[model samples]
Target: MSSETETFSISGPSHLTAIDWKNTYHRRCVVASLVQGVYILERDRQQNRIGSQKALAPLWWNFFHFQLNNMLVDSADHSIFGAIFELKPCLNAPRFVIAFRGTLIESGTRSRDIHLDLKCIVNRLHKSSRFQLAIHSIQETIGLAGASNVWLAGHSLGSAIALLAGKNMTKMGYPLETYLFNSPFVSAPLERIKDQKVKHGIHIASSVVKAGLTVALKCQHKQSKPQQDDPFVVLSYWIPHLFVNPADHISSGYIDYFAHREKMEKIGAGKIEKLATKHTVESLLSGAILDRISEPLHLLPSAELTINKSDSTNFRKAHGIEQWWDPTIHCPSLVYQYRY
Candidate 1:
């Protein structure tokens, strides 16, 4: 991955196919999900909780503690989705701090950060429900486990889910603070939100989405872009020829796309395959779909927080979010047009 871009999650039209996510977040999640899948969702005994590395309580502690330390943690998988969330420590916030990461639909290198290559990897790359369900599981676990001091956070795909969950909980009168990292798509449909419900105490948060100029440089390389029609066919060609730097995979992506295209064509219409193979990363980067423009599925957060160093009023765009934050402390919330 590049210097500033960090990876997390995704799935998309212009995404790569040969990207290996094993060293990525999905690996951690699939392992955890398998633990839970076969797990007897039963609580561990007080003594049982002591030594088991696979114990659920310790896992929660690790999950939350990672957040407390401002570190990102991965999510579980079934169709094998992945996510990242940073749980901040709650000194006296009066509530628990819970985090949920979003998915990337084909954004980065096979084993790199989403921030570096947003188009190489892919997952629930939109504001969709299946992604929402992944976070819903986390919520259910949080309540059942009695892990208090929760503040929800998400990086990319999970960012949108975190925003919506927090906003919905707020409207339902549930006290919560929402933070979305550098998300691409708008979190929720505007009309669905209520007026006073969002205004009272539940605050909407987000940051501005920005991009680095070099991203344009990477995409601008014509020789580096793919020229194939099928991803599966491309993989057939490149899988045997491994490269040293992951960045090289971007140029090699054309081959992966070709193979993936052929594979999908065997079953489906190869719609995404057709789209992925046709364009150069440079072309997409030149437009709105930058390979590193605020995480393809991430949201710029706009939340409120009063730091002791500076008051919230002093902060212009108090909750304005950017792509830099792995799981930003600020996020966007849907506030509908007010009605009398």
Candidate 2:
């Protein structure tokens, strides 16, 4: 195995018993790192020209007492996008974890993954075969081991897939515990602003405009009001764990996303914010032009947002999956629960 794959061992202590799985922070860090192992496993598969002498899956998962149950393959490019890890009997972790790898820029699957990324930008990722396979795998896992014993995890593009799958399963009355590391939020990089006042001002202006548009669309019958049991409304009750880095623009928007909602409410604009939160600019524009309603993949009604406060100037390092597992980083988190 290459050195890249070797890094998977650094994710946790040499022995499983050394760490406390009951600790929320430790568990979150470990789960995030296991997702990294999936990334390495896929990378090794893509680069390995000859069959390896040692097994790859066991190398990473066995340390955590989890066996690789299945490999999630991308039908389009024949790339390994994710894997299902089944916990050894009597382990403290979830019985099964379904993990997806993000866009691997240097791998052969790059083109296919990037295509899906584009699809995600326009909210068409659900129609892709990869996502279909992911959801199917989740459904199968739920059937085998109840939802409580299942976990969903991913990074970047993979995180987006996990998010969608989690949402669908939640709508079906099965909500799985999910860990999304550096999940891409397709929107303006509002979190990039250095000045708090400027950022807050822009957020207020944008929220008001979006709320106004949403109300106008409803008045003109352009957008119909969602019923009481709408999937998005039901999704409010299924809160996933979202890990983000303010230094990474792709995922950092989530910081502003959740923060702005609270700010709007404090200013007595809660009603407007609520209306705007139901829709996205991309979805509304696409619905008008294409005559089809689509929800933005990144928007979530509720989430436990964990922000990594580590100072990293490099974008690659900032957005990397490895950061989540780094023991030295300072991570502050908050839970955003939306009430219907």
- Score every model by TM-score: 0.29, 0.93
Task: Write candidate 2's Cα lDDT for 261-340 as tens digits.
Answer: 99989999898888788678767766667665466788999999999898987999889887776667899889998865
Writing each residue's lDDT as its tens digit, candidate 1 over 125-225 gives: 33344445645654654464343344555434344555445544443334344443433332222222357445211211110011123334445543243
Give the number of colliding residue pairs in candidate 1: 88
Q: What value does the lDDT take at residue 135 in candidate 1?
A: 51
lDDT of 1 at 72: 25
Q: Which candidate should be chosen as best, given lDDT against the real structure?
A: 2
Give candidate 2's whole-model lDDT: 0.82
Residue 158, model 2, lDDT: 94
The 10 consecutive residues of candidate 2 with the worst lDDT sum are 49-58
> Which prediction has the highest TM-score against the true structure?
2
